[model samples]
Target chain A: MYPTKYHKPASIEDAIAALGGGDDAMVLAGGQTLLATMKQHLASPSDLVDIRAIEGLSGIAVRGGSLTIGAATTHAEVAGSGDVREQCAALAALASGIGDPAVRNMGTIGGSIANNDPAADYPAALLALGATIITNKREIAADDFFTGLFTTALDEGEIIVAVNVSAPTKAAYAKFDQPASRFALVGVFVANGASGVRVAVTGAGEDGVFRHAGLEAALSADWSGSAVDGVDVAADGLMSDMHAGADYRANLIKVMAKRAVSASA
Target chain B: MTKVNMNVNGKAVSGDVPDETLLSQFLRETLRLTGTHIGCDTSQCGACVVHVNGQAVKSCSTLAVSLDGADVMTIEGLANGELHPMQAAFNDNHGLQCGFCTPGMIMSGVDMVARYKAEGKDLTSDAIRAELEGNICRCTGYHNIVKSIEDAAAKM
Candidate 1:
């Protein structure tokens, strides 16, 4: 690991200032991924603006018809928050299932979405639930927030303030675990929210998390598990490795989607 | 170097170390608290689990500088005058083989029991196993580990 400077800013402005010029400066939220990446020498940031301790950056609240999870809020908080459970139990469940207990205790929703790991569970839920990522600079819809594998619309020095979502009428996430890593082999998030029915898949896509228009249309029309059974999921652009072939992943997509619809219903 | 302060193991401790120093490195090297073992430092193996403020977090992956002015409780802090209930339970149940992962397993077990009890949720054996997902015993000695957690849950 390379020696770098660390700053624990008291406010968002201080954090952004600490992330000066932002090319090699990174905001350290939870540090679950960033610190580990640094240890492996895969990332050598010039400075890390520690955001988890910032007063307003860690919380869970439900106001009006929305649930806003602060960017620095840990996964354990989301998994255990009564407000989160009441507003979106599926989101809580998804948070609870990420990594192991220690990982959840340190990993944050902001960090999770920012890294945008291909097998991560948050992107699918955020996309299917139509979440709005509230950042210090601007608000980006989940649809536009995620661009591709390990990529997002975020620019340097842009700190994610919170993730806001309108409480869904019905929502559930079904994921097939990769076992060793506990990452999703093929996960599906099904929801009936403000945007009507939206279905998203994670872990299987070569381009990262993606919304399934076909499954969404089917679920919007029929709203049942059996409605997803006949949907054809092509393996053309999916991920294939020693863990699972793209063809197998395509089949699991439908299976998990059906399970998600069944759970949500 | 980064100057950090913390109340570790019920004592006020501070250090000036490299900015990139991990919590596990600080505990083992600077503080000479080798009980918090580091296995698979990539954050997969939970051998370095410790309590930051109150929750269990992987020390191997957590930066020491980020925890300035925080309270850190490690396996060494678990027992005050006598053995902690979880440690005793691990002993009674023979929950370890190589014992390299024992500190983390015990820390995670204690935290899991506290959380479940606070939530008014039952600490079933299945729940214990699920909660231990982060801490891996490469020896695959999970059966007794689960039993130890259940036993400690009852005693705690």
Candidate 2:
């Protein structure tokens, strides 16, 4: 890692101000992804604003028909949270399944979503559950939050405060984990809520986490795994890597989507 | 340089190191506590696992400066001049071959047992194997390691 200045901010306002001081300043939540990237020389921020000391950025609460999780809340907390398990078991399961126990103890939901890794698990859940990304600057809906691979709509110096996800009537996530990293080789999150049925696919999209409109439409009409049986996910515009080809990922998307729907049911 | 003060193995230590210094570096270089090994610096290997505020975390991926005032327990702290229960179990069960991943595996196992005990869950063989995902043992093929953890869980 390169030489960098570290600032521990006690409040969100101070964090933002510290970030503004350096053009290449980056916010450090759990330091799971950022630290690894820095170690690999992929990223070198001039300043690191450590926001873990900030009081209000780490917690989970259900309020007004939505489950609000602080951005700094660790995956372990979410995985073990009774409120989350009761309100959104799929979210809890997804949190528990990320990486390993040690990683889960350190990785934060905010960091995971903000990094917007294409193989990450949270984006699919956020997109399917129609969560709201609440940042210090503004509230962005999940639909507009993730822009592309390892990208988001967050602006420079913008710090995510919390995420508010409306409780779905039924929701579940199924993932085919890559053996080594445990990241989602292909993951699908299916949800049925007030808005309608939503199916989000992660780790398989060429651009990034995207909703499967075909599966969503079919499931919306039938609300069953068989509804998506005939729907074929296109291999074009899907990710292909050493672990899986685009066609294999397309098959995984269907299989995972079916599993998620069955689990939801 | 960043000034950091934290409790390590029940000892309050202070250091002024570069902001980019990892917790593993601080423990190995500054404090001379080499028990916390760095097998894979990419955070995939659990050789650098340690307890920060009673939770197992990858020290290689954690910044030392960020842990100011926190309580850290490395493998060296697992016992007080005597073998801890988990360490004894490993020895009795021949859990290690190369012994490179022993410290991390033991730390993670102890932590897993603690967490399971708190949750009132049994530390079954399946649970031990599942929780040992982070710690990679290339030599042992994890057969003895899993047995060691299961043995330790029983006594712990």
Candidate 3:
């Protein structure tokens, strides 16, 4: 790892100020990904603004009919929260199945979405639940928040404050995990909510997590596992790696979607 | 260099180290506590697992400077003077062959039991296997490890 300065900020304002101070300053949340990248010399920020110490950045609360999860809240916290399990069991299950227990203990939701790893689980949940990503500067709808792989609408020095997900009537997620890393090979989230039915697919997209309009339409008409059976998911623009081919991912997407719907049902 | 102050095992220790120094490095090098092995520099292997603020975390992936004022418990801290219950269970169950992953497995098991106990959940065989996913044993195929944790859970 390259020589870097570390700053533990006590407040969000101080964290932002620290970030603005350095051109290549990076916010450290849990350090599961950032520290590993630093170890590999893939990312060498001049300064690391540690935001784990910031108050009110790590908790779960349900307010005004929406689940407000603090950005820096660890995946373990979400997985273990009674309120989260009661209000959004699918999200809790997603959090619980993220990485191993240790990784989940250290990795934060803010870091996961901010990095926007194509294989990440939160993006699928966010897209399916119509979540609002709240940053220090502005609030972005889930559709607008995720731009591309490892990309978001967040500006430089912008910090994710929290994510607000409206309560869904029913929702569930299913994923085909790559055994070695436990990353989603092809994951699908299905939801029936006030906004109607929504389906989001993660881990198989070349362009990152995307909503499956076809499956959403089918589920909107018929909320059942069989509704997604006839929907044909194209292999085009899907990720193909040594783990799985694009065609296999397309097939797994359908299977996962069906499983998610069935689970929710 | 960054100044760090933290409690390791039961000892309050402080040191000044480079910013790039990982918690594993600090424990093994500065403190000379080699019990916490670094099997994989990456976070995948749990050989470097330790309790940070009472939560199991990968020390290899965690920076020492980040743990300032935090309480850390390594495999060395599991026992007061004799073998910890989990350690004894592993020995009795022959959970280890090469014994490379024992420390992490024991630490993770102890932490898992505590977590499940707090939640009023049983530390059943399936639960132990699921919770021990982070710790990898190249040998012993995990059957004995599961048995060991089950034995320890009963005693704990």
Candidate 4:
């Protein structure tokens, strides 16, 4: 990692100020991915404004048929929250399966979505659940928040403060994981909420997390496992790598979607 | 350089280290706590696992300077005169081949057992295997490691 000044900001205002004061400063949430990226020389920030110490940045609250999770809240916290379990069990299950226990301990929901890894599990959940990414500047919907792989719509000094998700009536996430990395080879999140059935797929698209309209339409018309039988994910824009071929990923996407649908149903 | 202060194994230790210093480096180099190994030096391998504020964390992935006022525990602090139940169980179950991953394995085991027990959840062998996903024993000695954790969970 390059030499950088570290600032432990106690408040969101101080954190934003610290971020704006430096040259290429980055917000350090959990440092599970950022630290590794820095060590590999993939990123070198002039300053690191640590936000986990900031109060009001870590908690889970369920109110008005929605779940508002503070940005700095760890995956472990969300997975163990009784409120989350009762209100949105699928989100809790996704948090529980993110990585190993240690990774989950240090990885935050804010950090995960902000990084927006192509194979990350949170993006699928966020997109399917219609989550709102609340930043110091303003709130952005998950659809507008995630721009691409390893990229988000966040401005240079913007910091994610909290994420608010609408409670889903029925939801479940299914993933075919790459054994060593635990990243999804292909993952799908299915949700039946106020907006109707939404199906989001990750780890297979060349453009990062995307919604499968065919599956969504089919499921919205008939919410059942067999509803996905006629829907097929094309390999046109799917990612192909040594781990899996594009066709294989497309197939896995359908399989995972069916599994998620069945689980939710 | 930044002045980092934290309690390690009940000792109030402070040092002026670089801002980029990892917690694993702080423990092993500054405090000479060599029991916390740095296998892989990345987050993938949990050889750098330690207890930060009573929660299992990969020290290599955490910044030392950011952990001010936090309490940390390592493999060296697990025993109180006698071996900790997890440590003794590891020995009895022959859970070590190279002993390279034992420290992290034991640390994770103690944490999983405590968490599962507190939640009133059964720490089954399958559950232990799932929770051990972070700590890797490349020696393929997971069978004994699982047995040791199960045996230790019963006693814990």
- By lDDT, the best candidate is 2
What class would a CAPRI assessor give candidate 2's docking? high
Displacement of residue B107 (Cα, Å) in model 1 is 0.5
TM-score on 0 to 1 scale for chain A of candidate 1: 0.97
**lDDT tens digits by residue: candidate 3, A106-219:** 999999999999999999999999999999888999999999999999998799999999989999999999998888999999989988888999999999999988898899
lDDT of 3 at A46: 92
TM-score of predicted chain B, candidate 4: 0.98
TM-scores across all candidates?
A: 0.98, 0.99, 0.98, 0.99
Off by over 4 Å in 4: none
Per-residue error for A50 in candidate 3, Å, reads 0.7
DockQ of each: 0.87, 0.87, 0.80, 0.82
What would the per-residue lDDT of candidate 4 be over residues B64-85, giving only the tens digit for each residue?
9989999999999999999999
TM-score, B chain alone, candidates in order: 0.98, 0.98, 0.97, 0.98
Q: Compared with the true structure, what per-residue lDDT tens digits does model 2 show for residues B5-122?
A: 9999999999999999999999999999999999986888899999999999999999999999999999988897889999999999999998999899999999999999999998
Residue A238 of model 4, lDDT score = 96
In order, the interface RMSDs are 1.0, 0.8, 1.1, 1.1
Backbone clash pairs for candidate 4 read: none
Against the hidden true structure, what lDDT does model 2 obtain? 0.93
Per-residue CA lDDT of model 1 for B42-152, tens digit only, reads: 788898999999989999988888888889999999997999999999999999989999999999999999999999999999889899888989895699999999999
Model 4 chain B worst lDDT run, 10 consecutive residues = B38-47
lDDT (Cα, tens digit) per residue for candidate 1, span A1-265: 8978888889988998889855689888888788888888999999888887678888988899799999989888999899988889999999999999899988999999999999999999999999999999999999999999999999977899999999999999999999998999999999997789999999999999999888988888998989988788899889999999999999999999988888883
For every candidate, give the share of true A-B contacts it also has. 0.94, 0.86, 0.76, 0.82
**DockQ score for candidate 2:** 0.87
